[model samples]
Target: MDLELEGKNAIVTGGSKGIGKAIAKELAKEGVNIVIAARNKDLLDATAKELSKETNQRIIPVICDTGNSEAVTKMVNIAIENLNSIDILVNCAARPLVKVLNHFHLKHRMTIFGMI
Candidate 1:
């Protein structure tokens, strides 16, 4: 089951848990070094340590809120700084739109949907 991904680098957003974490683990098992981003630092750190140990690949944890453009930018910068270049990007980060809709005005909602 060689993916031929040895030494490749990737970033997996929302990777602290669930599907994203699963994806990161598989990629690491395939020999890819990864950066796993999430809002929860504790979860991110724990996941990173666990995955690195299990797969024998570099797993860096980065705290990030994907909804914020600045935070995303910072996360990308950190990934590039650590991994040198990005070979893959798995954008799994998301929030419930229902909760978001409750918090924004109509105009901002349009922006959220990229209609603005």
Candidate 2:
């Protein structure tokens, strides 16, 4: 299918794994230049390398923690600098853990890897 996304640019957060990673891969497959941000530099680098090789598209990895406003700004700047545009924005990253108390018990929920 033609997504008409060739040469488009995108910034995908929490893109090192799970849904974010999947979105980045799909975008790359559709011929989009993508910038993926996560807190783990090593993981980001490895994912970037793997996706770039698989899709034959440019995938830039950035170390970022979206909880920080400065990091978000920096991530955007980096994406624009690398991809030259931000036609798409996929905010797939989320808190890794959430603990809640139910009516009778406690529950632990994981977001991102398990969350996404």
Candidate 3:
């Protein structure tokens, strides 16, 4: 399957690992230039380096938290500047935690990880 993505540009958030990482590797294989974003600078940098070596593709890892709108804006600007135009934008990120409110004490305000 040819995505016709040779020399394309994209941004993959939470790309330091997990699904984001898989997408990046796949895109790189398809010849899509990618900019990976995550909150962890160290992990991002290392992942970028490794991906670059593995697929021999152009991958730039950035420390930008998607939770912050400002960071996302800056990331967009940088992507535009570097890649000129974004042909693809893959925002595959996840929040690692979830809480359920089964019994919330009005005064204490307590919660549980999983509740019915």
Candidate 4:
């Protein structure tokens, strides 16, 4: 189970709960420092504190909304500054266009995914 991930830094988007939380926990178990980002301050703070207590790992909670370009940029910048580098990126964000992502008044649901 040695991922050779000791001292490595990781970024987990939508990491406040569910799948993202599970991923963060696994990474923490591997001795990886985690930067968890979400839009909710309460969720982010609570998750950070809980994870830190469970793993004794450095947990940094970043309040970021992935749908905003500016916020995404800020998250990346701050993560680079804080974690040194993003060795692992766990992108669990769900960008849906079902309600507001329509251009030209088109109706569609978009789940965007890509590497940063």
Residue-pair clashes per candidate = 0, 2, 0, 0
State TM-scores per candidate.
Answer: 0.86, 0.82, 0.81, 0.83
Model 1 per-residue lDDT tens digits across residues 13-109: 9999999999999999999999999999999999999999999999999999999999999999999999999999998898989876776777677
Worst 10 residues of 3 by lDDT: 98-107
Highest TM-score scorer: 1
Decoy 4 TM-score against native: 0.83
Relative to the true structure, candidate 4 has a C-alpha RMSD (angstroms) of 7.5
Worst 10 residues of 2 by lDDT: 103-112
Off by over 4 Å in 4: 100-116
Q: Residue 111's C-alpha lDDT in candidate 4?
A: 27
lDDT of 2 by residue, 2-73 (tens): 899999999999999999999999999999999999998999999999999999999999999998999999
Ranking by lDDT: 1, 2, 4, 3
lDDT against the true structure, per candidate, is 0.95, 0.89, 0.85, 0.88
Give one digit per residue, the lDDT tens place, for model 4 in 1-116: 89899899999999989899999998998999999999889999999999989999998999998989999899989889998899999999776666564552442223243222
- Most accurate candidate by lDDT: 1
Residue-by-residue lDDT tens digits, candidate 3, 1-116: 88898898889998999999999999998998889999889999999999999988889887897878998999989888888888888888765543222323432443433343
List ranges where model 2 is wrong by over 4 Å: 99-116
lDDT for 79 in candidate 4 is 88
Return whichever of 1 and 2 wins on TM-score.
Answer: 1
Identify the superior model by lDDT, candidate 1 or candidate 3. 1
